[model samples]
Target chain A: GESVGLHLPTLSVQEGDNSIINCAYSNSASDYFIWYKQESGKGPQFIIDIRSNMDKRQGQRVTVLLNKTVKHLSLQIAATQPGDSAVYFCAENKGGSQGNLIFGKGTKLSVKP
Target chain B: DVKVTQSSRYLVKRTGEKVFLECVQDMDHENMFWYRQDPGLGLRLIYFSYDVKMKEKGDIPEGYSVSREKKERFSLILESASTNQTSMYLCASSLGGSRADTQYFGPGTRLTVL
Candidate 1:
């Protein structure tokens, strides 16, 4: 079955350190990728997004890197804080689909004090 | 701030009962989506609506149906709720575009089917 998946299920990092999360997607036709952060008991919030035309996109303190060759994507959070502790997910969407998205299993990021 | 509100933050229901999950967005976005999140499963699309009275099935639309009578409101209905249907349901909305636009989400409705 077609699916998107993450490399790690959980990650623990000390505060102020940088964190990187990776995702693997199966759909080669996917043209857009999005990263989301979900805190406990809350819905997923958009962190950043990248288009297939570009390999990297940067937000305030986060960056999204896309590797079309390997069908992989990564999200990097700079100067992680305890507030950043949450599960992160990567989603892919092919333009031809009916506005549907394929989501990965998610990586739980823990920022220790 | 764009606000997407789900009617209930928590819901408990018995098996075989009909369940309705309501979502309303204040952004007036053209696209609305319903998804279920579970441990390790991330977020799975249940159904989505592009415009009023328009809907499309998503990956896990088997036990779900949707209603979009108006632009701001989208509803997810579980015809016959089952224990396996217990999960966190999330609603999101975004502007219609070639690039599956950035979505704003509601807090979520945690459904418990017993």
Candidate 2:
């Protein structure tokens, strides 16, 4: 069965430190990938995305790296803040499908001041 | 601003009860989806509609049915709610494209079936 999963279930970091969350996807046909952040009591918010043709994409305070050869993805956040503490998910778009995202089990990131 | 809205924030139902979950997108997206978010399981697709009156069953669609009478609205129906159905339901929409596009999500509905 095709599945997307995370390597870590939870992580704790000090404020101002860098945070990295990892994901592994099983579908070789997936070409588009995205990262989302979900805060308490809120829906998941789009963070950043990377295409299969590229290996890296950067955003405001986040970066997404895709390793298609290893079928792995990772999200990196700089200057982690308390507000950055949330559940982060990695999702992949299956090729040939019309915008259907398959998500991975999220990694809970906790930032301590 | 593009927004997806769900009818309920929270719902409680008994086993065997019929459940209705409604979602609307203001972005006029060509595609809409329904998913259940459970701890450790992530978001599992229940169903999706690419156009009005058309739908496709997703990974977990056995106990659920869908209706897309209008382009902006999609509804999920549970013929007989079960305890296993208790989870956070999320609705999302995206512009129709060749590959999976970035989806805008709704607040979500927490359902509890007892």
Candidate 3:
């Protein structure tokens, strides 16, 4: 089945370090991708997004990279803080419909202060 | 900001009981979605409503039904809840067209089926 998934289930990073989360999507038809951050006891919050036409997009402290050739995506966070510790998810628009998205399992990122 | 609100933060229901989960979005989005989040499985779409009184089954719609009487309100119904139905329920809304891919989610409802 065509789906999106993460390469790592958990990650540990030191404060002030840069962290990168990886995702692999199998659907070739997916054009738009997004990253989300979900803290404990809260819902998922939009992080950043990248379109198939672009290779990278930057956020306040985050960056999303898309590789359409390898169908890979990554989120990079600079100066990782304790508040940056959360489960990160990557999503792809559902089969070009643009009305729905298929989310990946997730990667738990822990910042060690 | 897009505000999506669920009816409950936590709910407990017995097996075989009918359960109702309500979601309201103030953004006047034309698209609403219901999803179940479980360990390992991630967020599986249960159903979605594109317009008032219009619905489309998602990837996983069995044992779940939905109603969208109004544009802003969407409801998910569990005909007969079972232990397997225990999971976190998430509701989201989107602009419903070219921009619908960007969705705003609610806090979520943690439902436990006993």
Candidate 4:
């Protein structure tokens, strides 16, 4: 079965430290990947995205790395804050069309202040 | 800014009842989707519409149906709501074409089937 999964269910980090959340996807044909953050009681918000042709993409305080050889993806957050605590998910555009995405079982990130 | 709005934030319905979940987008996007987010199941797509009056069944569309009478509005219908259907239903919209286009999500509606 084609699926997207996470390395860990939860990640705990101290405030001001860096956070790394990992995801493993099974589909090599998946070319586009996206990272999203969802706070409690809120929908998932887009964090960043990367394409298969690129190895890394950086955002304001976040970075996404895609390793197609290992079918792995990672999201890195710098100087983690309490407000950054949320459930993060990684998705791949492998659902047959560009509008559909296959999502991972989210990683809960808890930042301790 | 793309804004996707659902009809309710919390909804309670009885088993054997037909339920309707409405989603509206203001950006006039051509693509609209319905997804259910569960604890360990992740986000499963129920249905998606690419154009007016056109829809496609997604990964988990067994217990649901969809309607796309217009471009901005997409509706999800549950013929008989089941307790297992209790989950957070999220609606999202994105610009047509390209896998890199971002999908903007709504606040989500938590549905409880009693």
**Which has the greatest TM-score?**
3
lDDT score of residue A51 within candidate 1? 87
Candidate 4 CAPRI grade: acceptable
Give the least accurate 10-residue stretch of model 4 chain A, judged by summed lDDT: A1-10
Instruction: Report, in order, each candidate's fnat.
Output: 0.45, 0.73, 0.53, 0.53
Model 3 over residues B27-90: C-alpha lDDT tens digits?
Answer: 8899999999887788999999889999999989999999999999999999999999999999
Runs in model 3 deviating more than 4 A are: A1-8, B98-100
Q: After superposition, how far is residue B95 of candidate 1 from its true place, in Å?
A: 0.9
lDDT of 4 by residue, A13-102 (tens): 999999999998868998888899999999999999988889999999999988898999999999999999998988888745856787
Arrange candidates by DockQ, descending.
2, 3, 4, 1
- After superposition, candidate 1 runs with Cα above 4 Å error: A1-8
Q: What is the lDDT of residue B89 in candidate 3?
A: 96
Sequence-dependent TM-score of model 1: 0.92
lDDT tens digits by residue: candidate 2, A5-112: 534378899999999999988789899898989987678988888989999988898888889899999999999999999888888987778788878878889999
What is the per-residue lDDT of model 1 for residues B5-110, given as tens digits with 9 covering 90 to 100? 9999999999999999999999889999999987756778889998999999888999999999999999999999999999999999988755577778999999
Model 3 interface RMSD, one decimal: 3.9
Please state every model's RMSD to the true fold in angstroms.
2.6, 2.5, 2.5, 2.6
User: Candidate 2: misplaced stretches above 4 Å?
Assistant: A1-8
lDDT of each: 0.89, 0.89, 0.89, 0.89
Clashing pairs in 4: none
TM-scores of all predicted structures:
0.92, 0.93, 0.94, 0.93
